[model samples]
Target: MLIKVRFFKCGILQCNVVLNEGDIVTIWIDPKRVFLVKLAKGKRLDTDKGYILYDDIIGKEYGDVLKLSRATAYLLRPILEDIYLDLKRPSQVLYPKDVAYMIYSSSVEPGSVVIEAGTGSGFLTISLAHFLGKEGKVITYDVRRDMQETAKFNASVLNLQDRIEFKLKDIREGFEEKGVDAVFLDMPSPWEVVEKAYEALKPSAALIVFVPTVNQVEKTYLEMEKKGFVEIHAEELILREYKVKEGATRPKNVGITHTGYIIRGRKSIKTS
Candidate 1:
């Protein structure tokens, strides 16, 4: 497998450094199993093949492999998906399947200011922060302080605390940002805030809503249309996995069928 080396800024001066303790890393045992570790000086990780001391991994470079008795562990840099999937959060997250599409359909990229509602697990917020890079910012709002705390902690784990601004306010009340590039809604009552989202976004900016039920989708879509949002669309994403072998390959019987419905629309430049 090809290896890539990555570096991140460490301090106020923004000096780059190698991987260190508390940095999240991916240890691959095989094609099927991988482990996410936060390197600490005194910690130990025991796998089926063998145990590894954190001291051995704390200062090691990414893309390096440590050979154990029974398996070869490949240490690599962790991606957004890797960190997100391994997260232990109390709230239900937007899966990778949904996230990928949401980013694509909404045209979220580097240097785009984005607003996100209902920061449940911070998965989506993290992804937005990553894609926005250093040039852009994510303003995520949530009502519950506890949930916001969870999301804030997750952002800190990935060293993205500065990129996201967490707002502990109710969306129904209103949003702080105006003329933003895009808005993402993952809340229970997205329909209730469509007008607010329209006001927050810049003209021609995208308003994307993720809902779990068809009724919510219907209500949100109608609200967008009634509120004069153009280019309206609603979609459901389904993903299936397949097990492949040299001669045997088949789709997994059970797959991710329906996680949520996405409602997308562009803020209308024409107003009645």
Candidate 2:
């Protein structure tokens, strides 16, 4: 099925009018499955469920149900979770389960200035920007320019490009921004950059690290203590889904576990 399309930017993110040509829309199949597409005039998207015409999507408000040739789906705005799960991953990322805790522990909020290493597809970088709102800033560093460019593109998709400053350099060489509210490291050798993170953070600010192995967590924790960080702690998160069939309710046999270890601590002022 093909039809004509129209569009207008309603608000900062989501709006009521149907998506227009060139608008990026997420076709939500389920929590675990979603399809993203840039709607264009007279274009059609073929899926296992059915064929979705770009014209049929234009001007439909989000949350409206659409009837495809084979199935029904929801037209909706893509949230941070959708972006994180769907973006092209050139490197591993901190999933929402772990990222939530990291953001909470670091106390990232509106107007907060934060630093992060190894952008890694910009999952965490965009998350921080969402948390900081318009007044805050996120300075993220990555050694590879290609990865940084990918991250920047993802930020643009989320309309958060202005909230982040991407630096194509090694964070271990030291940071250009100082006294930041928080510094987060998602690199393989987070311990190597702990001192640099320490120097970049303000007194009482947080330093958070995410690593997949216990060895990395141990080394990072020790380095945090040695670098004058206090209240150091480490944790891991496991998420399970349950089959809520009313009469037959139980935990799903498959679930998410052991994504990574989060180590956090606070920088303290050095007294003479």
Candidate 3:
């Protein structure tokens, strides 16, 4: 299969390389290596290494080697995580660490109904929409029209526009949907929406709150407890990356150490 290669470090350069028949391709690329990429016919790519002919890679296998004018070699397929992280965002976005944890903890599935507040940059919204698949629904609310518009563009790019409902309103005042499977709050004062979230979630539904400060977490936890939420807990994730090289194995000096705290709980069943 012909695959496109992108450099995580270099934001501007993308390589389209062809996979010759009967060849196997690795899906990962080293960020530091220079690559010559083939583009579609009649397309050209300019790189610091040199100009590359788009036609050269038309029939190569995914892992086949391609040479740039500078003789630098590059792989054909790049990892999906690299592409996701490199996506352009109009606003600050939730990191993958937080999104993964939310998806796992909430048990988001093919038919889940997910409600999200403050869809900044639409990163988490896109992820959740993908996880929910065709049968699921993702309803996201934001007060800023520009943010919502930008998020719509991002979702469309991912082919998830049909699966998501973008509401240009503040979730703090209220929401339109009820009986949701999961609720994700990424707003500044998530506590303000706790009551509305409780009303919207189905019994025992998971609720996840993302806040950047300890104060916000504390307030949200207190409100959740007051609202009769069960199993209330907060956690922060730190990603420590390690360099993998022959004879050298140690954590990278710098990694995604801290982003924010996540507070999770379930709506308690009300007894009459």
- The prediction achieving the highest TM-score against the true structure is 1
- Badly placed stretches (over 4 Å) of model 2 are 1-18, 30-33, 40-42
Ranking by lDDT: 1, 2, 3
lDDT assessment of candidate 2: 0.83
- The 10 consecutive residues of candidate 2 with the worst lDDT sum are 2-11
Task: Score residue 74 of candidate 3 by CA lDDT.
Answer: 49
Q: 1 or 2, which is superior by TM-score?
A: 1
Against the correct fold, how does model 3 do in TM-score?
0.80
Q: Rank the candidates by TM-score, best first.
A: 1, 2, 3
Please give the distance, in angstroms, between residue 19's alpha carbon in candidate 2 and its true position after superposition.
3.0
Residue-by-residue lDDT tens digits, candidate 1, 37-78:
777788988988998887887656776788887988887777
User: In model 3, where do residues sit more than 4 Å from their true spots?
Assistant: 1-29, 32-45, 51-65, 71-80
Which candidate achieves the best lDDT against the true structure?
1
The RMSD (Cα, Å) of candidate 1 is 4.0
For every candidate in turn, the CA RMSD to the true structure comes to 4.0, 4.1, 6.2
Per-model TM-score on C-alpha atoms: 0.90, 0.89, 0.80
